[model samples]
Target: MEKRVAIIGAGTSGLLACKYTLEKGFNPIVFEAEEGVGGLWRHTIEFTKLQTTISTYQFSDFSWHSFAKEESPNSQQMLHYLNSYAQHFSLFPYIKFNSKVMEVEYVGESSEEMEIWELWGGNGRPFFSKGTWHIAVQDTKNFSRESLIKLVQQQTWRPNLNRRMMALRCKSTRRHLETGVHQREVYEAEFVILCIGKYSGVPNIPLFPPGQGPEVFKGKVLHSMNYSALDNKIAAELIKDKRVTVIGSQKSAIDIATECAHANGVKYPCTMIQRSAHWFFPELNILGIDIEYFYANRFAELLVHKPGESFLLSLVATLLSPLRWGLAKVAESYLRWRLPMKKYGLVPSYSILQGISSCRIGVLAENFYDKLKEGSILIKKSQSFGFCKEGLLINGEAKPLETDIVILATGYKGDEKLQSIFKSHVFQKYIIGSKSSSVPLYRQIIHPRIPQLAIIGYAESLSNLYSSEMRCQWLAHFLDGNIELPTITEMEKDVKVWDDNMKLHAGEYYWKSCIANCGIWYNDQLCKDIGCNHRRKKGLFAELFEPYGPKDYVGLSHKR
Candidate 1:
């Protein structure tokens, strides 16, 4: 039988995986749970815009220059661009829409049979031939409501529980289902690429005590995912003439609050309850200069310590620490001068460098501060909050804030969601052993223990599309026998080095697996590993100072 490759999710990463794998002459089947492409973009708020510039977010092989005039494309434009790319590459034919991957089981070598393996990818050969993957897929459109109810009852899935627990229970129940009401198909593949990005699948809902949960709130409570699932007209209607409280302080919270402000105006002001403040800028500019010049170049990256650096390089980084601090302060000063963050008590305690390191920095919507100044939006900083009969009860406050709508914009549990997809508990443990530690992936693609599986889009960069595309290209090269990974011990050591570097820069948010500040460095490693020229520029001056973007990585896979 011909070997088949299974690519899960038809979003940016999945599409790239399919395209690149096909370029390597492999047959790929793409499984997308949604009815269409654009994973999180399909459900985002209508007003949502790209966080980065268009040039930075485009695919290396395909440019978004047609939409270049708009620095930040809205969600619809992004979706259309992705659809265009899919069409341009003929990726639609490979996609199986509404087909959700329920579980993945490794049916290759037992513990005793695998004892002799030392090098990665099973003695430097592609691990795909060594093992086969059994994937359980459910046809979401054809699934019966009765089967869903029984599945939920058997698993005891609860809305109040965190999504991670719910996913675990659901996966566990799928294995022992004796009823024939469900329609599930099993797929066998030599390789599986998980392209499920971290932002959308399972929401990271905060846990609450029995009496202080969303169940106790009298008004309608919804997650940002649910709110974003609605069309613009319906979303506006849901919040019109209502007192709205948006919980959390990220991009989604800001966008939802802006929408509410637009809907109700100052009479029924939108209140944003923030647990912690993050660095958000009104524009990606400072002193009429693009911000990337200050941080996104090779020269700027030299100041930060990277994984597996030499002694001399470590000394250089340590000596340049003051310069890095000065740069961060300059950015911070510019943000304070430009935005009303200090006026509204939204200034974060963490430095701008830390924010960039963790990928926590966000671009604010236009006139966000103007809305605040006009009293259409209110910012409340609270350490803790819980649901009440009226609305939200800010901890230490005497009364609950009366509101008709509450939207939780807490982020998704990407790691946990990824972990729950595995049918084997051992693989789940290998994916994420602890809640505090980062996922240990060599090159942020392949787990040493799970060689047949490659995960893309979990690790984030300033431009997620660029990062995912680079990973996909490198993965294609590896699958085509052009690149070889190091041994398991070496890979583990490298993972630890990267994890340590993340901890050094990201502080408490190290688990995010963000390479935002060192994207060029990360891409260089990928290039070197694939036997391609890591230096993408012509001259040294342009290479060091000029900001690297998607254009730098074009035709990287073909070079080798």
Candidate 2:
């Protein structure tokens, strides 16, 4: 009972964390702000489809083949999969829906010899940490769409709940949803696992250039984070005889553009303002095999492995540079032949491999080219934007384009919310240093500085679901004292090694350091640590050439 843990979200990562926690014989209490299970997928538009195929977007212990009919399941199918996962694992009883964690404080450290209880009073029932630690959560009396949106755009700023409850109420619409019953509950636990993935947060909208006032545009502006709320009826009204301009070329932007094109037909004429050319996977399977088989498997990783300061791996990559370049060039050539990207002026300047490493790849939408040819969907290129009286002034154009609705498909600020939850002392010097996206976590799980806290889903993988499952396994074992961490200095050194390697290959940004680009290397390290068979295939040719996927890793933990 003393080994009680708090899971922040009931998303994929949180659900996996709970499963692994139970396997390790630890009590887990999952806190979800919403009334349901699936996180972003639940809130996503009904028309949304999986970026990766069903095979890639699956948990190791579970299979989607029986349930998901499509090669790529839609949002509703994904929600079904998640809900089924929870029910199958009997994780529903442990989940506390409509329970929002307002603040989490590291009250004090614990010793086996002493009994400690910390007290923090402010919002509702005075919080008392009877165990080693406690987390303050907002008690939701009822669940509504309005409350969910407000919760998504959390107004409460302070991590210390005792200090800023009423103040937060005044600053944000959080008070509107409350039933005038200010009640907050604290869960005393030994560890807090932050499984809050990058999705559900306030959208990242870049500020318009200087001289753009608050009332600059007379258009309806929204972020992709709230795309689901724009019902079909409202969408029809918004795009009714108006120029609809979507402001990005990424997955969401492309989806939004296609959706509007379909919704408005020939009436509105949706135009996608693409800033730069992005690589789109035209086909899920290349040569009748999954794309992951060709690029993300063990053998492919061996070709471009950069082992820190070791010149051996660098030598291998250099020696095979022609082959690597040829592969990417072939793919690019194929895409150009398959789609009218050049005619649309959406051809990329760099190789496909480089773009993939930089995380700039999106799955090609069906009939996108046909739509483009029919004039329902159009493309425009603009480097930057400034606001004028009419609409957005793009790339310093003298005349602004007349747009009635502008949807910013810009991504979420992934680390900002997590950063805001921790104290300055902990957040700055330890978690994220100097405004960098690098979490500096050892194995992308445990933080050397933040004791007893594990953050999952911060790092990227070819499949985030697969990576998260492995991370949960690592955390469960580590917390159970089955495995131990090296010294803080060693962990920091390891993190630096990863950062340096990423900078060398993909440049300075922290997202470049994602394990997705180096899937085999990252997984090998985890498997080695966890005492599992990382090698899935057997024969010499199979080991060298066969494409590794989730089936290979199924029952991987049992091998330990």
Candidate 3:
């Protein structure tokens, strides 16, 4: 029988996966939990959207229309554009929308021992997404390694010899269970592609304090995702009317504050609430889309980039935030003199460390000085110690300001929900096996021991461009049986090497607890996994990245 491959996530990588799998002759099935496609690009609007640049939003095969002239494309345009993309490619027919995969285990094997063997093999079920990570199982009972080995021997696994599976399905809104989405009725399929977009569920506005978390958020709290659609409306209501206090000065904050400022047709001074200062940059290119993707759409500060650097440089700047402030000051002083702008609308940004803002929250502080001149939105940079009925309390100073609505531009937590699926003793030990980092997957894609299972898009790139798309292609390289995967011993060695490196760099007892799997690590592994053909697939750069340092992160460039 022909290979039956499943694609999880209809967004960036998943859609790309569909294109590749079909080309390679695998019966590909796409599963998306959302109502439509486009992933995060689905909501690139003034209200609810991601802030990645456009030039590199897609693969080499396609480009975004809004990127033609605009520095950034808003939400609605992208939604339409993505729909057009799907229609143009006829990709929608292969998708099963509104169907969610509740559970997926190796099936069809007759022997229980064989079932157990396939379960423990690499590339086990459930292909996870970017920034979505899970640790490995440390025990055998949960996954039963002996049984999985038997399954691999007896079962006709993937040609690549991996056994891990990408198990998940699309889903409709929980509220729809009471009703339904048109006539779709939400049907389940053998395969799944979850492009549920990186930001899952309703964009949650985090309460500042725990029980005390913004408990006194009296002025109608809301998320940036749920703001006023009409620019004039938000401007008319918020301009110079009340002392507006926008929290978390990220992209959303910048957009709203700048819009509010420019709309006032004057300098609007609003206090920007945040913990630390952020970095700033011009928008040159992102995901292959140019800053014009937004600028043409009437957005200020649309151009967010530097003169000569790929987008990935910005990501390393953020990832190395711990050491970026001092270095940033030096760079800024030099840049101000080198490329001083006669005038810019927005400047003092909330972007911290090396420019690229963290998690893309409501951080539009660059537009602050320009918009603030109108005396509408004030810049409040101090951290909020607490909150009361009147307003936010910064550094113990209870500053009560007239407010209408509190739009929380705060972003999301790393997707830990996937981890909950196998949080039990049986699951943890099964996945972890003998790894040191607790995450045992090889090259951050497939588990070495179990070849069929592969996890792509679980990395965070400094360059938002083509990360998802490239990763999908990378996955294709593996699934098509054209690439190399690490041996179990090799993968375990990588984990231990990483752990040893961590101890060496951060001191033996340092807390590596908060560390989530990142792109740099995976990229390095990708290079190492290549056959000893230095002249073939492994180029000089992929080889060089193995020993890169934090300061050297600016050289984030890598080749396949």
Best by TM-score: 1
Compose the digit string of candidate 2's lDDT tens values, residues 346-372: 898766776666666778776677778
Which residue pairs clash within candidate 2? none
Query: What is the C-alpha local distance difference test score of each model?
Result: 0.82, 0.69, 0.43
Give the runs in model 2 whose Cα sits over 4 Å from its true position. 109-131, 141-151, 154-181, 229-242, 287-289, 308-314, 508-512, 558-560
- Give candidate 2's error at residue 74 in angstroms: 0.7
Query: 1-560 in candidate 3: lDDT tens per residue?
Result: 22446565666667766776665556566655444666655433343343544544444555665434554456666667667666776677766554333333333322333334422242333332111211111111122335433421211111112112223222211222221212122222223333333344335455455544565667655555445322445445644444455676556666666655555443334556766444444434323343323222211111222212246854553455444344335545543443332243233443222132222212133445544455665665565545567665567554555455555666543233333333244443545454334344444445444324455454334333344444454555555555654445655666565444333322422222111123333333343333222222245653332322222221122244
Off by over 4 Å in 3: 47-55, 64-67, 100-197, 202-216, 225-244, 262-269, 285-330, 334-366, 420-441, 447-453, 495-560
- Ordered by TM-score, highest first, the candidates read 1, 2, 3
Q: Residue by residue across 1-560, what tens digits does model 1's lDDT show?
A: 34578888999999999999988888688878767788888888876889988878899878887744688889988998999999899887778776778888888676445545677546665644566788888766655546544542211111211111222211211333322666677777777899988776577788886689999888998778778877788888889999999999999999999988987899999999998888987777778888889878999989999888889878989999999999899889988988878899999989898899999999997778888999999998887788888888887789889999999998888888899999887788889956676788999998887757899998988889989989998999988889878888888889988888888999976668989878888999999988888988889999999999888987775454
Pick the lDDT winner.
1
Task: Say what the RMSD of model 1 is.
Answer: 5.6
Alpha carbon deviation, residue 443, candidate 3 (Å) = 2.9
